[model samples]
Target chain A: MEELMDILQEFEPGVDFEHCTDLIDGKILNSLEILSLVAEIEDVFDITIPTVEIVPDNFNSAQAMWNMICRLQEEE
Target chain B: MTSYCSFPFLFLFLPAVIVVYQLMPEKKRPYVLLAASYLFFWLISGTLLVFLLFTTVSIYSIGKRLDREGEKRDALLKTAPRDEKKAIRQLCQKKQRRWLALGIFLQLGILLTIKYSGFFVENMNQLLKWQQIEPLIKVPQFVMPIGISFYTLQAFSYLTDVYRGVTKAEPKLSRLALYMSFFPGLMEGPICRYRDMAEQLSAGGKITYHQLTYGVQRILYGMIKKVVIADRLNPLVQELFDSGTAYDGGLMFVALFAFTCQEYMEFSGTMDVVIGTAQIFGIKMQENFERPFFSRTISEFWRRWHITLGTWFKDYIFYPVSMAGPMKKLTKNTRKSLGSYYSPLLAGTVALFCVWSLNGLWHGAGWNYIGFGMFHFMLIVLGNFVEPPVAWAAEKIGLNRDSVPWRIFQMLRTAFLVGMGEVIFRASSLHQGVQMLKTMLTSFTLGSVKNGTLFTLGIDRHDFLITGVALFLVLAVSILQERGIKIRDYIAGRKTPVRWMIYYSAVLFVVVFGAYGNGYLPIDPIYAGF
Candidate 1:
């Protein structure tokens, strides 16, 4: 989760990831930033991401994304 | 008077519909909205209603097929053997894929033939004739259907979304129809998406008094922007560009600046009207502009101006190109060869090129538009390159981004950049654009103003006054908006007498000041040509 926050800092500096649940909803992360974040998340967590779950709602917020990462790790 | 939005229709047709709609049962509201929308389209577009109907039925049916195929494919993938599942999925998807392609191709084909055939044919004829050969093609005149480009794009986006499983296919035919031809968004679009607007279309949500009042006030703001600032700026812009030989550098530059403001106020103001109208029906449409003139760079200019189109390009074109196999491999290869820093830049440039070129082409089919795209691409990429330097310069100058003068300077700089782009955009041809550019650099003067150059463009004192008043209204309204004030709240707080008076006064002003009577050519809504 901390690593995820670091990656998001690239989108807009000084973002408080803890406060954001509507990342996608609020358009805080554009599509390109999302792609970059996905790559970083995959590398950081050493987990593969399926393309099927790349919908906007799943990544709209930091919490939603954190939960998604947790779920994938549990499955592993 | 012939415009569906004219006095008689507003005073009679719209009010009657509203009265009857409210009197009717709530369950039948969707049907009523559909009827009213189609009737508006039919009345305004006449026989072009057939085109709207055709699009509605074809897209509606195509959505149904795509949804079924998606369901079948998902089911097969879960249970069948890998080979069998793959084969079954491909077979099921093929027809659906073709149907979607056919729908988009047909829509674009119709748009091109109607909108671009004359220009295409004329250029071909000129080229052949210059070679002393008999011209193979002759240009034909075609009356383009109003709102065809906008609605076609909207329908295509909706269908494309459903096909991709980004959103579900809307099941109800009438609801789909309403979504496509919803009166406010039909003529010029913020390009509403199915996933974004579907729920609003199906259900007429509860409207707060605040919303009702703010909606009407916003409409007033939009009307003033259109009638005053935009219409006023049109004449000088036309004259200077139409005969560039007559103006010196200073006047031409001013003309260009004025045109930029005119275009922004005109288009964005129209959007405000569209959003306001939707708000009246408790529908929340996407906002299309956000004080784009205040952008510090060309990239920010795009983000702030015509924002929906920018997002559409990013989502539909840029993302796909950046992530697609070839581009992905290029990014990977760059990383392998040049390292990570170079990879993102390489990918970003390719993505930017695709998006910007498409953006340029989306404005119109011309070399000038292509140039317009390249020009902005250069600025944005260059802005990126100079980011560190610009930051250092700002720090050295003790300039804060939040400072009033800095903000104003950015706005002025953006105005200059955008104004030059409009010169090319509004020019008749590349040669004319070049000629205008040259004249802007060389033959400049304030003498033309003293010699009645302004009057010769066709605007008079009345036009200037209306423009001035309209601009004041727009600025006042925008200030309120910036302060987080919604116009509806103010109107909602007012007594019924005050509210009704405001509405009636707006109607009167639009009727009187709007450029619709004799001696005025009804300019087709500009984006419709796209």
Candidate 2:
């Protein structure tokens, strides 16, 4: 979770990823940012982020992203 | 009927279809809609409807094949030892991918050959001539089936979704067929995905009084926009664009702005009617527009405009291309030095180039459309690349980026970018597009607009006044809608007489001011050609 938070802050410096649930809905993490985040997560966690798993629900908050990362890792 | 807005369609065909749809048993209603949709396609495109049928049959079969492959893989995985399970999965996955590829090729094959082969042949002939050789191939001209471009994308989305396990392979052929042939979305699509439409297409319900009233109201509003504003401005737009060099840059600017207005009104207006028609059947279709002009940047504008296409590209083109094994590997390698901010952009830029290239060709086989695509590509790339620096600069200048004035300025800037791109998109050729652009930059003076020169082209002061007043009404409605006010719901809640009065007034407005039937040529639905 901390690692995910650190990565998200790099894309949007002022965004409070921990508390905010509408990261996607509120336009904090847009498609470009989401792309960047996906690449960064895959690099750090060594799990492929499939296109099917790139939905807003999977990346709307830090915990959500962390959850996705864990699930992808478990599947691998 | 040739158009959804045509009297024959609105007055006769649609009403007849609705009456039949409501009278049919709920279990049989979807078939009625599907049959009507096919008839609508046939009415417009003649025997070209076969192409749509070919797409539907191919996708439906391929989708089921994918489902079987998945089941086979699961069965194998169940029996295999844990050590060999991954290997079996990988092997099965390779086969599924092959099937997916074939399905995509088959779906796009007909579209590519029918829609773009002529352009390819013509370009090839040009290249051969440039090499001092005889042009061997005759430049073949072809007619595209109406909705080929729109329905093909929907088919593509369906195949990919099934492969990705996002949507199950629909076993029922009729459901898949209905998804592809739903007449409202057939012509100028919002390019719906299968997962979005699969259940909605089959959800049968009767048209209630509210549904009927609201649907008719929304359809009327769309008709007004098409006839009263978009069609009204068509002559001036045509006159200026057809021979803009004869006028000052001021008039060229008029051409740009007028075409932009016409395009938005026509496309989005059609969407209103499409969504409204679907609403009558109790199926909630996705919206294609969200007041795009209010966006603060080109990127934001695209997100708001023709939203489904943007999402389709994001899902199928941008993400997949950029995040493919090779691109992801590149992003990883670059991240070691270029870091997070720029690394994905490297891969993203490459993917965006592909998307825009295809997007340009997707609009038409014209070089200007490709140029239009390239123009937006540059803008979006530049916009992404500059975000951090622009933020830093804004902070340095102590600018409140969120202020209304700042936002409005941003919106205007975005609108200008869109207008310039539309100038390219609407131009007859690339050279003319460039020439008009150069004129706009170099000889930009509003003298023509200030003088009485505006009245001469096609529209007079009276026409301009009507369009302006009509536009103001649209603006007022958009503003209200933007503030989270649902105009339809608001009207629905009104007293019966009041609602009737408002509806009657709307119909009267269109009847009186619509640009048709008296020396006015109603411009065809613009995107229908694409």
Candidate 3:
């Protein structure tokens, strides 16, 4: 979780990614930032997140992204 | 074939469709709608009904196949050992991706072959001639089907959503077909997604009195905007743009601005009628325009105008390209090499390039259209690049960016930029657009307006007065809407006499001030050809 927080902050500093659930819908994390986050998550967790899993629901909150990473890791 | 605002459509076709639709049983209402929609398309496109049918059948088949693959993958995951589950899922996804790709390619291929072949061949021949080689390619003219661009996008969205698991693949082909060819949106569209509209379309219910009245009132409002404001300006805009080089810069500016106004009224007015017509059937379609003129920036202007198209491109093209492997890698490298503030922008610029290029070509297969797209791209990119510097300057100068004067200035600036872009879009060709711009920049004379040249362009004083008054009313209503006041609902809450008076006046305004009858040619919906 700390690692994930670090990644989020590095991707987009000063965003309240831990608490904000409207990250995608509210346009907080724009398309480019989301892509950056996805690449970081893949590198750190060593799991390939499928394109379908790149939805707002999976990346809106830090916890959601963490959960997705863990689920993909387990599947791998 | 009559337009949505024409006498035949307003008095005859719509009434007939509504009566039949309302009288039919709930279960059979969809079929009635399907038939009506096909009739509408047939009337406009003649024998091109086959194209709509082709898209409908192909997308339905592909969606069903993808859904079965999804179901199979889930079932396998349930039964498979933990080690094999990943492999099984990957296999299934690969197969599904192939099917999705096929579906997209088929639709886009058909669109390109019909709509863009001439453009492609012409460009190729130009290049060949420039190289002193034989022009081997012949530009083949096809009677391009109407709404192919719109329906193709919707079809792709449907297939994409199903693949993404955002929406289930519609199992019933008939339901999918109706969703694709709904009459209200068949010509120019808000581009409904399967997930957003499928259930509402399938569940055709009884039309209540409120729905009926509201729908009729909305349609009347649309007619007022179209006939009174848009149609009235058509003659002047046409005359001005057709012989753009002949006019002085001042007159040319008026022509460009008028064309912009005419386009907004015509397109958004059509949307109002389309959405209103759908409302009478108890189906609420999405709103396309939200006072786009009020936007203070080109980017915000896009967010408000033809809103669904922007959203669609963001979802399908912008996001996918940004998040694709190359862009991801580029973002990472930029963040490390150039630091955080500019990294995302670097990646965004790349994706934006794709989006804008496609957006330009999507309008029409012309160099002028491409110029229109690139012009906007340049404005947006320059805005992004200059934001930090502008903010610093504002802070240094103690200028409150939020002040009303500053806001108004921003709005005007954006409007000026947009008007310039529209000149290129409305020009007959790229070379003509360049010549028009040269004329605008090199020459300026107030004498044209002073000497009655403005009035001679086809509109006299009476027409100007009517247009001005109607435009003022539109502006007032837009201001209210910007402030979140629902004019329709507010009027609905008034006393019966007051409400009826409002309704009657709206109808009367169109009938009295509208540019129709002998001298006026009904301008087809601007975006319909696109």
Quick one: best DockQ, which candidate?
2
Q: Against the correct fold, how does model 1 do in TM-score?
A: 0.86
Query: What tens digits encode model 3's per-residue C-alpha lDDT throughout B61-137?
Result: 99999999999999889989988987998899899999999999999999999989999999999999999898478
lDDT of 2 by residue, B5-48 (tens): 88888889899999999999999999999999999999988998
Candidate 3 — which residues are off by over 4 angstroms? A1-23, A27-29, A36-50, A59-70
Better of 1 and 2 by DockQ: 2
- Relative to the true structure, candidate 2 has a C-alpha RMSD (angstroms) of 1.7
Best by TM-score: 2
Clashing pairs in model 1, backbone N/Cα/C closer than 3 A: A23-A60, A24-A60, B213-B488, B214-B487, B214-B488, B248-B443, B248-B444, B249-B443, B249-B444
Which scores greater on DockQ, model 2 or model 3?
2
lDDT of 3: 0.88
Docking class of 3: acceptable
TM-score head-to-head 1 vs 3, winner: 3
